[model samples]
Target: MIKNFSKLALAAGVSAAIALPASALAEIRIGIAGPQTGPVAQYGDMQFSGARMAIERINAEGGVNGEMLEAVEVDDVCDPKQAVTVANRLVNEGVSFVVGHLCSSSTQPASDIYEDEGILMITPASTSPEITARGYELVFRTIGLDSMQGPVAANHLISLEPKRVAVIHDKQQYGEGIATSVRDTLEEADVNVVMFEGITAGDKDFSSLVTKLKQADVDYVYYGGYHPELGLILRQARQADLDATFMGPEGVGNKDINTIAGDAAEGLLVTLPPSFDEKEVNQALVKAFEEKGEDPSGPFVLTSYTAVQLIAEGIEQAGSTDPFEVAEALREGSFETPIGMVSYDEKGDMESFEFVVYEWHADGSKTAVN
Candidate 1:
């Protein structure tokens, strides 16, 4: 079930005004920020579900310090400009911590606000290396960054021995960063990066780009972008008889890609985080999703769960509702989460796991290839 926190209000002194000044209203307030209403709503929905599930499970077992966890969600629309506003709003609302601003573009700017406000922030799905490389004390992520995933995909492509590879990007930070990394890695491997280019996001026609690839005789095309543009590229390439196998980053590894590309989506390959379904420990999580009528196998669910668990553990260690103490706790140690053991480096970057290779089936289900 979907829940929104737009209407929640925090009372500054309500905790102090309680009967026992020592123990306040007993509500641990956390922020949930994401693209709750936009082209990337699915990502936000998956993230929100994981957070909700974690909170429900924790509450059922008795919340931390005898306080119930209350998450207030703010929609950032996955836009960088809007992200700053959302971050300020979350801070203004007196949330103890935050989990969101999903897109890398959004995460980058929103993180500054979090640091300025001394609020703890964690992103479950934004994988761009730049997001964490800033060395902010308050920012953290549950997933590995593009610095790892980009090269993994590049190495995979190089192993396939494609004669000529073409690279394209949506010109966004997340997309372009991954594409540049892949292009550099492929070049390092002495692979022919025949065409490296950037295309506008939300482009309707990729015929010109496809024609250029066909003329270059490219056997493989690597796209560092989200699913919608990838779908259009694949469909247009097939229609133009470009005949190149499409590859993309995890951002493009969604069932929605299949819906957009249909038959053209078949045989598409992508590099993403390791399969969550393959982990036996996540059976309960899968069951929880089913009980809530959500698909546990979705892209961001496991990571989202990990994010919430990370925050909850931090809260527990801090033994208080103060965001500063929780941030200190998170940076000082690791949390054993559903994704695995997650710990932060000095820069608040996670030294966690590697990305996985997957082939998107015609039906949109992914099969692990690596």
Candidate 2:
């Protein structure tokens, strides 16, 4: 009877242990939100892939404060309304930190939710100046603002000394803002901007715009938009035999443009964040990504990786996952990341960031301009 009782007790103990919820393990959950399924899903793919790689590396080496890190991802489709829904879901999931909402349109709306909930959001790719300028204590970005990129693009075009410059935008907040900045900067430089226009983002036909460019005898065209429209315009321009130089902001730097514009994507000039893949320090990471059948050279990959590193480092420094504590720690210290050492200003903007110009090659690759 005594042996049977002991056996029964042991069985009960094992049963209780098996029945315990997995949540009892204790994990630090971080959210990664972006357009997982949309026109810009490529950007989200890069962001999430880099984020997952960081989380895996950190957890493998022993997580922050002994709590394992877990990633929670949501698809916002890069739409403003969907972004709000995604933000609320992350809040409900008890995620104190977020690194996402890649598009400016989505990030702007989602930021409001994060600010009100006291959740810290650090975007890797949203570049609208208004994001940092909005006076939100919990908002930050790893990438430089379009305000800095616009002038660089303008100067590049001016250096070419085109006969007549034409500027176009996709009519979105990011597209329009950068386009206006480039236009204004060019005009201030006493350059002739013969044509300024806006087009819908999803429009497939740019034949009319190509006609306008030809009619204006434009030698250089600066477009402030994503790669899709820019690619189409370049293809159509080549079909029309326009023979004009095309330049764009960072939004047009994606490799997808190679497929969209084919050989016409060659000779395309773009202003983008400094390519981190070229750095010797990132070679191991690049290899790790390639081993996983992923490309680490995407525009947002390094920045997104840096975003995750920032959050993990901040959590370690603060010794807590509390969003407020992490935010304070992030602002108080500089972090060395895959991109380089980064320090933030009070406004949550990087103290110093660089944008470089690159020329696209025919083989779907880009080389940084000296």
Candidate 3:
């Protein structure tokens, strides 16, 4: 009787041990929200692609703490109202970490929801300084702020020695904020800005604006807006036989501009972060993207990938999935990623990110200006 009892006890212990790891292997969901179906869908698509690839690689390598990382994508369409809804949905779905809401307009509103719910968000593209200036401990961004890039744009235009300059913005938060920064910097540098104006974002006709620029005899036009409007302005400016050099922020760096403006995009200038496509460490990632029939050279691609890597590394460092603990861990350490070493300041902005000028060519390619 004693021997039979011992055998049964040992068998029960073995059964319990066998079930432990299986229960611990449950997947953890990470949210990736952006404009998956709108004017800037290409940016969202790149964010999704980077997150998907990161999750796949991390899972294949045993994941975070032996549990798989799964991405739950939500399309906010870069709209503020839609972003709030997406944030609520992510909270309801029990996502503890999020990467996105690419535009500052959407990110600003969505961040409030995440903070109240204790969800940690890291944006890869939104550059407005206000995004971090809100003092939310749960908010962070992988890109530099407009305050940094604005001066760069101003200085570049000043170096061009244009007799007069014209500055235009779409009047949205991100567009207007960067535009205002550039205008202020130019004025401080004593550069003559002949015209500073605002235009509706979705307007298809910029002939009137081009006519104004022509009348001002502006040799350089600095546009603080997205690719669609910039593309149209470039085309119309060319059609009107204007020889002014067009410059814009990273918002205008998308390849879609090439399609929109055709050969007129050849001499367009843009300010953007250093190119990640030429990095030796990113060759594999670039090849992987090509194999999947996607371009890996967009402005936000590597930054999005770095955001995912930072979250996973934070989880590993914290030894828990609790959002508060992970946030603390991220603040305490630096991460090495495809974009190089990334460290955040107290405000959750990258410490070493820099913006450079690039000139677009007719073959749908951009080269950095020395």
Candidate 4:
């Protein structure tokens, strides 16, 4: 569990902007839980930036019900065990809601604790369907699930009509789960799936994997994992002179991939949340993020902002601070958020969410292709 004294230590290496407003009249405390130090902490930066911005803006607008909101942040380091520890820390601090547990593996365990403890949680990035499939009233997210993302990628692949496709994963919950989804969808669509394999998450060398890909004579590769591994795979594959188009889910859609893979990152296809910052209606909000030196274009930023907005609105519509009432209000109402109109199904997932496919470039920018 992260203690008060270690907050600075956690922030030292992370690039996320932190804005914590302290009010004497703090009534509702929202716990921000995610990685402050980990391999995937770059994504955590988006989560923290969006939630902190929302908290700041909401408090500036006189808060909810005349009670100012407070923030209690915890670092889980994107590790499931650390997530459980931080979730318990949030529980002990008596936070009414949480905005994180970013990685799906971490979110699952932390959500189990939150559900039992009656803490309302809205993960802005964790997309494993299992998190919400258990029918937990408290678990919700601002992002679409692997079930939604996989088929989108596969359908796009089908349209391209590749001769042979290879699917790879990191063997973790999020990676393997989405990889399986893509494989299943491809098989159903009568596409030739040459291989489906798992790779170690942190492995640096992919020479052997490159050989396997070449041996399979695959023309396209679909990776289900975060950017780090995929970035390395792209770099090594480029060195080995393997010719194949690479596509991945949003998990591998970070700008850091450009840094890792260098020029090899160009032409990588990724399915991600729509560019909310690019929407005209959100220009002012995008400027607000820019003014504060935050990058709003990252996939999780606006979704996380919407998570905080939903919680605040849910509380107001319910006319109570009880998390149960807030949860019910969230499921029953439609919200106009930066992402778009959000209305939850009975399982607490958005009834309609859009995932756009983008063509990534080596300059750390992407253009929508589908």
Clashes by residue pair, model 4:
none
lDDT by residue (30-85, candidate 2, tens digit) is 89999899888888899999999999988988988788889999999988999999
Q: What value does the lDDT take at residue 167 in candidate 1?
A: 93
Clashes of each: 0, 0, 0, 0
What is the model-wide C-alpha lDDT for candidate 1? 0.85
- For model 4, how does the per-residue alpha-carbon lDDT over 1-370 read when each residue is reduced to its tens digit? 3685578666753524333323333568999998888899999999999999999999999999888788899999989999999999999988889998799999999999999999999999988999999989998899999999999999999999999999999999999999999999999999999999999999998999999999899999999999999999999999999999999999999889999999999999999998999999999999999999999999999999999999999999999989999999999999999999999999988888889999999999999994
Pitting candidate 1 against candidate 2, the one with the higher lDDT is 2
Candidate 4 — which residues are off by over 4 angstroms?
1-25
What candidate 3 gets wrong by more than 4 Å, as runs, is 1-25
- Lowest lDDT block of 10, candidate 1: 1-10
What 10-residue stretch in candidate 2 is worst by lDDT?
Answer: 18-27
Query: Over the stretch 13-128, how does candidate 3's per-residue lDDT look in tens digits?
Result: 89989986566448778999999998989888888888888888889899888889989999999989999999999998889999997999999999999999999999999999
* lDDT of every predicted structure (CA atoms): 0.85, 0.91, 0.91, 0.93
Give the clashing pairs for model 1.
none
lDDT (tens digit, per residue) of candidate 1 on 1-370? 1233322323434543664544435777788999898787878888898888888888888888778887898899888999999888888887868887689999999988888888888898898888877778888888788889988999999899989999999999999999999999999999999989999987888898888889999999999989889998898888888888999988888888888899999999989888785699888878888988987777687888778788888888988667788888988887777888887778888876778889998898878884
After aligning candidate 1 to the native by TM-score, how far in Å is the CA of 301 from where it should be? 0.8
RMSD in angstroms, all models? 6.3, 3.3, 5.7, 7.9
Q: State the lDDT at 8 in candidate 3.
A: 94
